[model samples]
Target: MIEVPSRVSVRDLAKVFQDGEARVEAFAQITLEARPGEFLCLVGPSGCGKTTLLRCLAGIETPSAGAIEHRLEPGAPGAEQAMVFQQHGLFPWLTVEANLHFVLRESPVPRQEHDAIVQRLLERVGLARFRRFYPYQLSGGMNQRVALVRAFCVQPQVLLMDEPFVFLDYQNRIVLQDLLLELWQEQRQTILFVTHNINEAIALGDRVLVMPGTAGPFAREISCPFGRPRDVVQLRTNPDYQRIVVEVTQLLRQEQEHSLREGRIG
Candidate 1:
């Protein structure tokens, strides 16, 4: 696979939807950047356009305004930018192993190397024994992990994930979070992960970008003071972790309160 620059820049970005005669602004003037191999997490209230923003970054949705620039090498798709939605998006008919292989179909990974790649990923997720299980046969967390494996198999330079584990139960979610950090440490891809869970955001991101509830710029940018090689279970017990959570929760509340005063949101 070809290596490409992982830096992503979004400038004066905005997304608006036309609801008949009404123009609904999904978000506006959103500017941010994620450096190479950086894990940037986005947190926002419902309808704040976090998912929409990710879709735009993935080239799945066109923005209503502004520009998103990726400094990829010319003639390369930047290790082929990959996006994972909240939905597993896996083929139900395909077994877990088959699903991972499916994504490699268009990837630069040689067909002969596909099996080894899949083997490594499945083992990493501790799902090697269940490789033949279909999506319907696996739990939500397992299926989501498979989805993660699928994305990583492509060896994307930039990974945009929208609430990939939001639907899972707590235990599964933490395990996956740790697994994700491990995978990311190995691949060092530029990751932009969206989550409503602030603790999850704080646990995983290098910096947390809050989209907020109002019609203005982002609420705030909070840096995670924790060092890398983070353990989800251990992170929660730290005093700094509690402080950061309070700080983020307050910011989101401030945004929502401001929106309420302005009558922008309920």
Candidate 2:
């Protein structure tokens, strides 16, 4: 079996904004990598630049300093990376098939294969019969499923997701999480996911990074060694899973306190 190339690398990454005379550091000295075909979850407090870091990885924002490198495997099928946003960015007017086709049209795949690829993904997600339905016609979870499939439809080498299911209730969130895992298990694309929920992070990530706050980059990297095809509901009750979640949550709390103290001193 051939090894997949490392999909992304960030070195001494920093993003700063100028607010009048004051400098705002979103995040700095953030060094990390998205291992080939692995899921990496990022967790942090609000204003800690999780989304900013993700946007930088997506090439949607220029870093004020440092570098982000993306290496594609030889003969890779599509773009180097694709991002799924928190808002479930499906076009309101486009049908499900049309939404997926919109992405494929931008990929390197042959135009004639677009329809077949779109149909296959929709079928896999159990949305085959809703191909002609618009975004407004579907429930929030269904729309999110479409957004996810659309991202995968591009067959990207890396997937960057920023809390794509954060707004959904527990049932919907877990369902989409399972759907995401299923798609990922089949394709094994490199993924960098950002979330506030520690349980969600542990449930889906191979490694979870905890960001301290705006004052620091990533403060800790916790490894989750659970076996494949994880059942979130069952994992919730598993002692090992609970232990990891508590460890991660404690780190987050400590970071928040540290940040508050530093703020007062500054």
- CA lDDT of each prediction against the hidden true structure: 0.87, 0.87
Worst 10 residues of 1 by lDDT: 71-80
Candidate 2 weakest lDDT stretch, 10 residues? 257-266
The residue pairs in collision within model 2 are none
lDDT of 2 by residue, 121-171 (tens): 999889999999999999989999999999988888899999999878899
Per-residue lDDT of 80 in model 1 = 57
lDDT score of residue 41 within candidate 1: 98
lDDT of 1 by residue, 123-239 (tens): 999999999999999989989999999998888888999999989999999888988999999988889999989999999999999996865578899999899899878999999
RMSD of each: 3.3, 2.4
